[model samples]
Target: EYPDATATDPTIVPFGPQEGESLSNCSTKFLERIRDWCVNKDALPQTVDVIKLLLVERKKAECRVPTHPPKDESTGDVPRAIVEAQQDEIQFPDEESK
Candidate 1:
């Protein structure tokens, strides 16, 4: 019965902030923006590169913010170097950015 129930599938949806969860951050929004933009943009690889560069630059720029020190704000966030490495690992279908 359970298998049959799932077999007749209707529309499925992702559960998140819209469904009443505490979801709010730049990273989440950044990923969503990238996904949407890449859908219609040409040269996917170049687009991805631009996104990664923008992300890294943003992090670096924020590091120099005078109001709040980066150390204190990012005590639990991923290390910038690791984040950059992960960005490099990002692979799209065509691998056009290389």
Candidate 2:
């Protein structure tokens, strides 16, 4: 007799390390980049949260999954001020190059 599976079925897909890249090294590099960018931008608490969320989305993209299915890109847990700051930084990145 086969048991009925629930809606939240945990089908595990084992992911091995990418060619020449261990998971630990990849994670370390990812976090270091995030930290450097955040520090350069003088990130607030909300900005940190947004950065983390973005990283998660990027990971999902790498895994060939949908990015943030429930949450829309424009709307997240981050504050409006932080979101605005991030937008401004994107638009005026040259200012930081000087």
Candidate 3:
């Protein structure tokens, strides 16, 4: 028999912008809050983890594209993974700003 489980609800907090405000710092704070709630057994743990993961993934996607393209204007077929991996090893300076 299912008993009434309406006694539980989570308190939501909002983020503020100011000095030292950055995505990394904000994400860490958000995860800590989620951990506090989960450790106290106030909310679902998996949901919080998924949200954290999504924020991290979105940041990665946004950073993957170059803010400035190479000067050659050649859109090569190489996958981003290979380019990123070789970037440091090959030491090719960015041609975009030239």
Candidate 4:
């Protein structure tokens, strides 16, 4: 456990201000608060992370056009596997038979 409340010592910047293409691009700082929330089962910071986020900002000049999947021929929109998720299902309530 952290002492002196370093975890929440400084409240994180409001969510709206943190909105940016990347953390480095945001005018506000947020990484410290994010780090505070990460820990292992022993309540200790885990050094061995299975996956890590590496957000880096690139100059607009250096950015390249991203490839996208073909859009639906009829709808002219990108196809989503589900209404909400890449792979998800939408459920409807069953109506009672008369």
Best lDDT among the predictions, by candidate number:
3
What tens-digit string does per-residue lDDT give for candidate 1 at 1-98?
23544336532222222211112333465566667667867558878695777567556644543332133254765434333333433322223422
**TM-score between candidate 4 and the true structure:** 0.21
Whole-model lDDT values for every prediction: 0.44, 0.46, 0.49, 0.33
* TM-score versus the correct structure, for each prediction: 0.34, 0.33, 0.33, 0.21
Residues 18-83 of candidate 2: C-alpha lDDT, one tens digit per residue: 332334444555566667767888876767686677567556635753223333357755433333
lDDT of candidate 4 at residue 1, scale 0 to 100: 50
Per-residue lDDT for 50 in model 2?
60
Instruction: Write model 3 residue lDDT over 1-98, tens digit each, in one string.
Output: 86434335345543421122333444566677667867787668586675777576646744653544333336554444334433423233355733
Per lDDT, what order, best first? 3, 2, 1, 4
Q: Which ten residues in a row have the lowest lDDT in candidate 3?
A: 14-23
Between which residue pairs do clashes occur in model 3?
Answer: none
lDDT of 4 by residue, 1-98 (tens): 54555356554343312111222323123344445455323433442341132222222312431234356799986644222222222322234521
Looking at model 2, the pairs that clash are none
Candidate 3 wrongly placed segments (more than 4 Å): 1-10, 15-20, 42-98
TM-score of 1: 0.34
Highest TM-score against the true fold, candidate: 1
Q: What shift in Å separates residue 76 of candidate 4 from its native position after superposition?
A: 2.5
Name the weakest run of 10 consecutive residues (lDDT summed) in model 2.
11-20
RMSD of 2: 17.6
